[model samples]
Target: MNNKLKLSNEHTLARVLEIKHYTKALFSFKTTRPNNFKFKPGEFVMIGLIIKGEFIFRAYSICSSTWDNVLEFYSIKVPNGPFTSFLQKITTDSSIIIKTKSTGTLVLNALTLGKRLFLLCTGTGIAPFISIISEPGTYIKYNEVILVLTCRYSQELQYFNYKVKQMLKQPYIKLYARNKLRLYLSTTKGSYPYSGRITWLIKSGMLIADLKAYNFNRMDKFMICGSQQMILDVVNLLRSIGYLEGAINNPQDFVYERAFVS
Candidate 1:
């Protein structure tokens, strides 16, 4: 019997360090990061499990800052998802496969200069934003950073809420985050102070009104991640107002990624 791990040249093995479950369906895990592994905030990489001598992989947005020694990922368990069903059962004893390369348009470098940076996401889509916000470079790039997270239930927001609090309390981050970071939570199905889809909140001006922020304009940049429908609706709303989609080579007013959609 062979116990040695086997992986392709482009992949590496990482040991699971910790796991936290936010809800029956939502969970996050941390894994040991290879010394040579590097990525920008908001980028995503392919990760997977080994089963029956076969590797099953999925794209997962990184949830930890680039400077962190360990990599973190947020996930949602699907009833019989090929990857997630097995992934959810993993413990610290497990080792996962991680592809070396990482890429995504949600990165800060994808957007042009802007006064305010708005990060809008739904469900596990909040993963990359967590990495972005935790990066000290993010605070230096914009005068204000707004993170909007919408989920089906209020409980789904607990993990992010705790992360935000931790950032606000960290000495190095608190100084800037306390003044620049703003979080708004919304629930589509359950009771909450804010309710309804984020697209509606934005179009109806309820989100801006609640933030007491200046009206959205060419000078504001947006990063969005969520389901196909959520992304389309939000993109349409922004495009109608003259916002252009951005790319790594071409900087524009907004960018988006669907890595966490599953």
Candidate 2:
């Protein structure tokens, strides 16, 4: 008559460490990582909770640096979502199930050498980019790293702001990436320093003004993660300018992965 929940054959049970709510729809949580669980920054793994005696899982980008002892995830609370609705209710000390297989194309290994690296995202797509920038490899590979994040409201940008500030203040990061990392933000539905779709910004040359470059050349590498439409639009835009898609086996000018499955 044992009632203890048994760990699934393919998943590991992780203890939640902390949780922070950014808005009604967005939140982030940290969970203890398995000592043997290893993954590159920018990769993703399936995570979920048991509901109605069944486990429901969803792919989530690992937001924490690879070096972090705890795993972190940024999530959107979709109303009636199969997993999120339940996930949003998670609290510290709760159990989270994580699949060990972490895979994605957003890692640094998928991009060729370039002088500048652009990390473009919208909403929770910013998750993978957070991991990338925190990894020292990002700073060592490029002289400049540009991070652009667009959200529906200014409040949604708070998590990014905090991470960016922390990255800049760290002695190690400051020494290597000081004055090299740049953050651009836009709020689509509210007033912010920037307001507009990132694609429009790129097409209108406004983003380029900040880039201080007229064209996207081979010297620039782009890692994009966001909505399907956003990924498509940016991919087309980059292709129009001769940027080629890259992969682990054949690194090229750019790489991308969907932030969430639509």
Candidate 3:
């Protein structure tokens, strides 16, 4: 990936069609999709700002499912981030630049078939998991799709609940039933049910205790997304437990990526 971000010639001043605030720092936006544009849900897109004759670009996960015509993204308002500081202020129909290309390793193609799949995340990292859960293949291919989400409080969980309810009602996802999709929220700071950092939850045997119905064997695949340190910590723990990383070209026991920071 390029370290120094620059606007691509293909960038456009697209209009924002809608926005939904999920939390003080978290928000979701929907924009008019460029003509003939196509992308998988888990992919990340480069969004840029063309203001005051200078361009700034940042990567963001495409939160909406592929079947949707418009592009959607869930983002965090980084207090003083060059991009997010302004990106969060976008109102309906405001013009913003978006790159044509979408890329990332979080897509379903990165992992192999497993009896159970764990889509692990924290904070805004839950963006991609929303896409994975809504995809038709998720229910068709995996016996159990458990989304283990970690956040500071339960408010973040509400957005997920809304999305899950919407997904379960869809004709394609109706087959999911209750067993196919399970949610495990680990709230770290707040006094929520299952309170602690996700890393501790897993290492302390608390995670397993929370999901008493099943035991994690090598047969389970894990897809993790979070901060760089969080990814490294989770992957290291998985390795200690015999879980291997997978890829689109070379499948394994797990797959992960650095979450998009503002």
Which tens-of-lDDT digit does each residue in 76-161 have in candidate 1?
A: 99998888989999999998889999887788988999899999999988999999999888989999999999999999998898
Candidate 2 scores a C-alpha RMSD against the true structure in Å of 2.0
In what order do the candidates fall by lDDT, top score first?
A: 1, 2, 3
Model 1 TM-score is: 0.95
What TM-score would you give candidate 3 relative to the actual structure?
0.91
The C-alpha stretches of model 2 lying farther than 4 A from their native spots are 1-8, 211-214, 258-262
Model 3 segments more than 4 A misplaced: 1-9, 258-262
Clash tally, candidates in order: 0, 0, 0
Candidate 2 TM-score to native: 0.94
Candidate 1 has its poorest 10 consecutive residues by lDDT at 1-10
Q: Candidate 3 at 150: error in angstroms?
A: 0.5
Give all candidates' CA lDDT scores: 0.89, 0.86, 0.80
Best by TM-score: 1
Question: Against the hidden reference, what TM-scores do the models get?
Answer: 0.95, 0.94, 0.91
